[model samples]
Every structure is written in structure tokens, then in C-alpha cells.
Target: MALAEPFEIARGVQTESETVIVELTHEGMTGVGAAAPSAHYGETTATVEAVLPRLFEVLPEDPHEIDAAHTAMDRVVNDNPAAKAAVDIAMHDLVAKLHNLPLYRYLGLDATETPTSSFTVGLAETGEMARKAEAAVEAGYEILKVKLGTDRDVEIIETLAETVPDARLRVDANEAWTPKEAIRTCRALDGLVEFVEQPVPAEHPTGMARVTEQSPLPIAADESLVAPADVPAVAEIADVANVKLMKCGGIRPAIATFHAARAHGLETMLGCMIESNASIAAGVQLAPLLDYADLDGSLLLADGADPFDGPPVPALDPTGVVGTGARRN
Candidate 1:
């Protein structure tokens, strides 16, 4: 899928995202999902494609046996979470459709009070980012997630804050700062931003804990919190846990991770890769369970670039929908 423009984050830049569509058919009903792999998590389109057939072989005969399916897939192979997520999402879509209910209804989630998603402002020249942010606000977005990590991170954020004073702002550093640098930057951004995300590397837990201990604003753990087992450690260092379907396998694991985060007393968030509506729609169904949402992956794609259509975003309304609402456009 082509992006509307180059999307630069602290880690790198991409002009297009490569995604693989996965489809499952059961009792004359077809459910669709897509894999938007992330190399940072050790998976790519090729890796997902390579492992999917094997994973498919282990799928339970019944869609409702999702936990069993996950165990079977894990036994067959180690990582390759994006591949597993594709299958898991398709199963959820299929099961919900079979029951004539929306995915949220099947999972028993309430959509009445879901938080609106935040539109991301990927790293760019300071002025260009500001222009994009202002344009997003004009286009009807009330919250923005700005990518930071540049030497001018402060300047870029300050510019956007001034440019759109009324817009809610959140900054993600994507593990770019040193412990000292993170603390200093977080203090500088205190009231100007909502929270700082993954300021130090996930491998450096001690560094993250130090930054979290000293930072003035809340700290969100993205890379630091990958699965349920990591929740305890993450809760000790961060105030918020950012869960991604691609990172933790899929909907089932995401749910488990969210519950674990809550059990450990960390605020929960759901984020996504630059994905298609095929998978993003599934994320939207889980919105009511989140304290924050960064589900603008599909919205970042160039118009008509996505091959599938799903739920509405920003608004994240799952009203009166059957299945996961992901179908070929």
C-alpha cells in the first residue's frame, strides 16, 4: 500500500507498506485479514508468507477454539507473530460472522465509550510536519500523535503545539533517546504533550525505568511491552502499555496483554502498524477496551490504495456491523 507521502519515524522512513491479505472460508462465509509485518519485530512479508501455510495446518477445526489454535501455532514455530495475527483475526471475523454479530459483540466489548484514535504526524522537516498537523486538524482530527527523535524534537513539538493549540498531542520517540536525554526531553514536554512513548531502547529496561522515574509526564511502553509476561516489568517502568496486534500475535493475545496490563495497574493503549482496513477494522472493534488508541494506520494510506474496506476510524464506530467489517473494496 502506498502512503499519501513519505512517512518518517525515529527509526526510519517508508514510502509504501507491504501487506499480505489472508482469507478464510467457513460455512459459505468468508472472513478477511491482512498482515502488515514489521521488521523491527523480526517479521516481514516474506517471513509471514513463509510461515502461514504451516500455521494454517495447525488451526483448530472450530473457530471458537482460538486459544487452542494459538497454542498449536506456537508449538509449530517460534515468532512470526504477524503471520499468526492474520490467521487469528480472520478466525475472529469468521466466528463473529457465523454468530451474526459484530466482532466486538462476539468478544463482549462495549463500544459506547471508546476513545477516538489519534492521527500520527510522522517525522519530517519541522515546518512540513507543522503544516501536515494543521491540515489534519482542519480535516477534522482533534488529537495528533507526533513522531519525535530528531535533534529538533523539542522544536518540532513546540511548533505543532503552537500551531494547533487546541489539538491534543502525544509524542512517540520510538526508542531514540538516552536515559538522561529522555528525562530532559520529557520534562521539557511536560504539560505540552500527553505522554512520551518508548524513549529508550526496549533492550535497556534499566534506562527506561530511570527515565520513567524522573519524567514529569506519563511514560508509555511500546517496544518494552510485547506480551503478557512483560507486563509486570513494564508496569514498574511505565504508566501506559501500548499493545499492537502485529507485535503480540493477534486479537486473542492482545486481549490477554490488555488484561495483564490492567492487572498490573498500567493504562492500556492499542496501536498499529501502517496496515490495511482488513486488519485495522479488527483493532477498531477492540477500541472500547483502550484508554488511548493510535489506529490511524489505514488512514495514513493514499486514498484508494487499500484493497479492503472496514470500520470507520477516528470515530471508531462499530455500530450495527456484522463480522469484522473487512471486505474487498
Candidate 2:
């Protein structure tokens, strides 16, 4: 799908996110999923497509048995987490549809307990970012997640806070700052943002620890927390851990990471890459278990081409439940 506008972050700029949509069919029923490939994770559309035959080999004969399906997916591939996530979501969607329940409710979650997903604004000039901030607030977004990790981080934050003073704001540095730099930046951005995300490189937990210990604002770990096992190490320094479905493999692993992070005394944040509603919907299903959410990838997509005939871009209901999953037409 095309982006409503080009999205820029510390990493780069893009006008669109390309995703592979998948369909799982059985017994006169069908389930759908989408995969957003990431070069950071060493994944691409061609790579994801290459793994499909292996995924098909382990296709769950019984979609209702989600656990078995998930395990089968885990066994099918070693590093194609996004591809595994697509198959995982499709299996879960199929099960939920068969049970005639929404995906979150089918998983026994309290839909009312979920938090609203944050609308993200990628990095840009101070004036440009503020304009995007204004548009997001006008469109009913109560919380805004901004991309930082640039020299103008503080300036951008100050301008955006002034532009939408009432709207809650958060910033993701994406591992751009040094230990000392992170501390200084965090101190400067103290009241401007709710928290600072990945202010230091993922490779330096000690730097993150130093910033977390000295900074006034809470620090959230995005790059550092990749799996359930990776949670405890980062939780030692970070206050919040950001869980992305694409990053952690899929729903089952994401749930595991959330619990693990909580066990280590870290709050949870549900986030996503530039993704379609297929993956965004799966993340929405898990939002009830998180303290924060940045699952607005689909909202940035000019079109999701959502084959499921559901609301692809979420409404940012800070108080209500958002629906998810796909069905056969």
C-alpha cells in the first residue's frame, strides 16, 4: 500500500510499505495474514515468499489447534520471523472465525482492557512534524508517537509539544544516542515526552542503564528486546519494553515476551513496523495486555487492500475495543 505521505525516521524515508498478503483455507473456510519484511531483521519480500513452501509443509490440518500450528511454524523456519508471523496470524484468524468470535475475545482477553494504539509521526523538520501532529490530533488521535534519533530531537519535541500541548506525546530515538547524549537529551525532553525509546544502541545495555539511571523520563527498549529471552537483559535497564509481532515472530511469542517483561518489572508497549492491517490486527488482538501501543502502521498505509472487508486503519479508540481478524469472502 502507498503511504498517505512519505514516512521518515532515523533509518530513512519511504513513500510506501510493501507487504505479502497470505490466505489459509480449509473446510470451506479461509483466514488471511500479511507480512511486512524488514531489512533490519534481514528479511525481504522475496525471502518471505521463498519460505512459503516450507510453511505449507507444516500447515496445520486443524486450524483450531493454534498451539500446534504455531509450533509447526516455529519448526518450519529458523530466521524468517515475519513469514512465521503471517502463517501464525492466519491460523489464529481461522480458529477465531470458526469459533465465531473476534480474535481478541476468542483468545479469552477482556476487550475493554486494551489501550488505544498510538498514532506515529515519522521524523521531519520541526514545522513539518508539528503539521503532522496537528493533523493527527484533528483526526482523533489522543496520543502521538514521534520518531527522534536526530540532532534536532529536542527542537522537534518542543515544537510538537507546543503544537498539540494537550495531546500525549512519546518519542522513539531508535538507538541513535550515546549514553551521555541520551542522558542529556532525556533531561532536556523531560516534560515534553511521556518517555524516550531506544535512546542508545541495542548493543550497549550499559549505556541504556546509565541513561535510565540518570534521566528523568522513563526509557523504553525497542531494539534491545527481540524475544522473550532478550527481555530480562533489557528490563535491567529499561522501564518499558516494546513488543512487535514482526520482531518477536508472532502472537504466541509476543504473549510470552509480554509476560516475561512484566515478570522482570518492565511495563509493556505494543508496537509495529510500517505494516498492513493483517499484522496490525494481530497486534490489536494483543493490545489488551500492554501498557502502551504504537500499532498505527495500517493507518499510515494509503490503502491496505484489506481483503478481509474490515477496518484496516484503526479508529484510535482510546476507550473502546478495536476489531481484528479476516474471513473467506
Best by TM-score: 1
Model 2 scores worst on lDDT over the 10 consecutive residues at: 314-323
Can you write out model 2's per-residue Cα lDDT over 138-205, one digit (the tens) per residue? 99898999999888888898899889999999988888888998999999988788998999888998
Q: How many residue pairs clash in each candidate?
A: 0, 0
98-191, model 1: which lDDT tens digit per residue?
9999999999988889999999999989999999999999988999999999999999889999999999999999999999999999999988
Which one wins on lDDT? 1
Model 2: lDDT of residue 308: 37
TM-score of 2: 0.93
Where does model 2 exceed 4 Å of error?
303-323, 326-329
Q: For every model shown, what is its TM-score relative to the native structure?
A: 0.99, 0.93
Q: Local distance difference test, per candidate?
A: 0.93, 0.81
